[model samples]
Target: MINQLSWKVGGQQGEGIESTGEIFSIALNRLGYYLYGYRHFSSRIKGGHTNNKIRVSTTQTLSVSDDLDILVAFDQETIDVNYKELHDKGIIIADAKFNPQRPEDTNAKLYAVPFTDIATELGTSLMKNMVAVGASCAVLNLDIEVFKDVVQEIFGRKGEQVVQKNMDAIKAGYDYMKEELGDQVGAMQLEKGDGKKRLFMIGNDAIALGALAGGCRFMAAYPITPASEIMEYLIKKLPTVGGTVIQTEDEIAACTMAIGANYGGIRAMTASAGPGLSLKMEAIGLAGITETPVVIVDTQRGGPSTGLPTKQEQSDLMAMIYGTHGEIPKIVMAPSTVEEAFYDAAEAFNLAEEYQCPVILLTDLQLSLGKQTVEPLDYSKVEIRRGKLVTEDLPATDSYFKRYEVTEDGISPRVIPGMKGGIHHVTGVEHDETGKPSESAANRIAQMDKRMRKIKNVRFKTPVHKNVKHEQADLLIVGFNSTRGVIEEAMTRLEQDGIKVNHAHVRLIHPFPTNEMLPLIQSAKKVVVVENNATGQLANIMKMNVGHIDKIKSILKYDGNPFLPHEIHSQCKELF
Candidate 1:
């Protein structure tokens, strides 16, 4: 049996829920435990309940699940709100003074630890989270040394005085646990591995690093939840790399400025969430018509209009696909893992330039904010594709240069300003072989077809659909973006249970990998589509192209929480 433990620390927004979770995570990671954490909170500074769930395993973990093994209640309301999620054999640790009227029939082991009271005795209530941490370690029989190392790592930079106080608080809580409940505690063992092999990073940082590697010289964005970290990370790092990062006035300005940077012969990127993406739609269309190579990273959040700004959602799939007006040929792709985010960002820039169109990298809030241990990307392995821009001297044109000069591949040779006789006019209106405003229906059709053809061509050049064990299984599971890791992990578990399962995760969403996907679906006995979005956009796309709608089953979630492997496995079992 897989040993899984989830700890929920809930309290008012400012009561150090995140700090406690981080401290636990640091300790667990140092102790060689594989962990996955998910956090939920309101968009308030104080008084609203916030909950952070951490899933820890002795083995590698890819997703966060629903069942809780331990609930560390900071207040009565926290226990009230999330008590039902605890497993029957689980434990609930709460403050003795604030015990709620829990159900008498419930089988969960309850321990009333006076966490706040202990913190008061330690001279400050600030260490209540620390108290919770110590109590949890005591119950789990986790190493006290691990907690000591975590405390020093987190608070040692402050000063000796603060560090000493926190350490004392930790020891006090540990002692309290030993005095109150002695040998009920049992230790969980973790497998040893080479520490240097792992690289820790959050999704936003990985995306920024990818963009930098892809020769992104200019970035413009307005701060928005989930996507804000990308801007913040790039802003500090961009200047060091001789690049420019601007915090624009709004999302509209951000997109437009990024387009302008692209026009000035630099690879440019802008990032935002659903609401901000709406603001950039008009400018996105303008980029499309002008054939400007700009990358827009829409780290999607829930919405039609500002719905759940700080929450996770894949609802923007349709919005990103058809948000722009008119026939705009743009590439849309999503990365599944932190490593994929890095590589996808670089590939996004390449596609934007090669197609001479805007590309939206559709990442969601889950992947954006989620932290994981990933392998450090090798910069030497990155191939920087700088599009068709020529730096060499061109033969002098008798008249003005034709920027939209159509070729066999529908891609025109592009030249930057200050290049000899390469300057040309770019407009949103229909243009001929020469770049100028034209009202002719024929020119419009040709331009539209040319733009669409570029997307078609990209299908051949881009990465193919990746499958883990496609050949050996009767059932196949398909997913995209952040769902990739969870689905893969689920497939592994199913295989272990004697269910022959295969999996495919797509990195290229648009121009959906027809050649690679059609054959796989045809061979599989059952095809299941898994996604984080409620409407099953990926499922719909597969039905539209692959022609086996009846065989494809969808397991979708849109509750502002990600799909856990256990959840997916349970769903797949139902289908089986």
Candidate 2:
């Protein structure tokens, strides 16, 4: 009676894994099952050990389970590296061409299917992935028609002969498995899910979609790992919508171009990982100083150098929040899920245009690379807010536009190029209200004051922290970015043990949600600030908001991996 199952496939890189996992996940999605899929790979192109873990569940899943119910091994290293994580009663399906190391005298069942052999007989060994996928579905009691349909759609371009060969490979693998491993693995399958279809995609895809919905018509970025999907998606869809995605010479050119487009008055953005982000800092400051509205998506990964490019980490909090030279009022935000990634990205444009400052939308490897199920986004919720822009004809006056006008709210009306009576100068250098270079003491004071004074007046929603319990909580766990799923799961386990616990996740990283977070931290008897960084960056941000930050404890992990729910549960258990 397995209500939910965690299935995984391990093989060498460049072995058609991406397509295999994608096909399986899509079929599962059609059957009304939700999947949270994560890819573990190396920085190299091929011949490296890689794996995809797909958590298939009747209920929506956000985190991978600690153990695997089905381990499909393509080679011996796949078995050697992951045997311990297999459930005692789980079954392993190995390709007969490779002798995968089996658990010694263990109850976990192991069956070898001739994946490559069967595929080769059908004219190509490349169909080995299809054979394995078929065996995986057959053992789980899923209908083969679903797999067949996806195969035809994927391989139909090659003509009927090629499609039929793949069909034979799939059917052969399924029949072989059912004939040999009869009720052993099939025991895990339950009734079909509700048949309610849902969209299944990775985080990068959502971010690109969000950019489109956010009215971002221009993008200039140098592709980087884990974050490149956003650029790839935009490259495909942007031009059809009368937009543009320019692959620049480097991050410097990318950021500068985005700033130039924004200055010309269009929603524009550039995305990058750590190294590229470091290169764009100067331009980010330029956007800040010039008060240009632009968004920068930093899909974070292990850092300092070229640290684990394929791994997940929340190590960019301090870097993004405090980056750039001198002083610039900036808004930093982190989205906790795929759904939030879309909306937060849209709001990022709104905030940037409204505040006339650069906005950094932060995401870790987990939230950027991991694929998961998200409810359909309501595009109606997407309302474009182009802030303080003067598009109408201003009575042809001799006065130049005060693009940097000092006001009660620090925001000034912006006009694009060629606007009559709106011609003004703008530069990275310090400037006055009329965009003229100014070095006088009074002007400097007034300009700096105007730029920095908007912190209090920047209007955004309250409770940026997702509070598990709004009332007095026993223990308050504060985390940001990708830690939301695990924290939510951990809180449920803690309450099951009769311990009243509360969790708060901060989505908006800058302007530090002080008024909203003060009461939550104060009410909790014990507060734990959980993050993936070493210094607990969230804790530092909290100290600036609520005094006596030492009252909150820290649970941190920086090992190039995300926190699992059981890991967080164990960490919280120690506090009691």
Q: Against the true structure, what is every candidate's RMSD? A: 2.6, 1.5
**Residue range 276-383, candidate 1, lDDT tens digits:** 999999999999888889999989776668778777777777777788888788888888778778888888888888888899998988788876666557888677
Error of 1 at 408 (Å): 1.1
For model 2, what is the alpha-carbon lDDT of residue 232? 96
- Candidate 2 stretches greater than 4 Å from native: 462-465
TM-score of predicted model 1?
Answer: 0.92
lDDT of 1 at 90: 74
Candidate 2 is scored at a TM of 0.97
Worst-scoring 10-residue span by lDDT in model 2:
461-470
What is the TM-score of each predicted model, taking all chains together? Answer: 0.92, 0.97
lDDT of 1 at 162: 79
- Compare the candidates by lDDT and give the number of the best one: 2
Candidate 2 lDDT, 54-131, residue by residue in tens: 898888788888888888889988888877778788888899898656869556778899999989988889999889
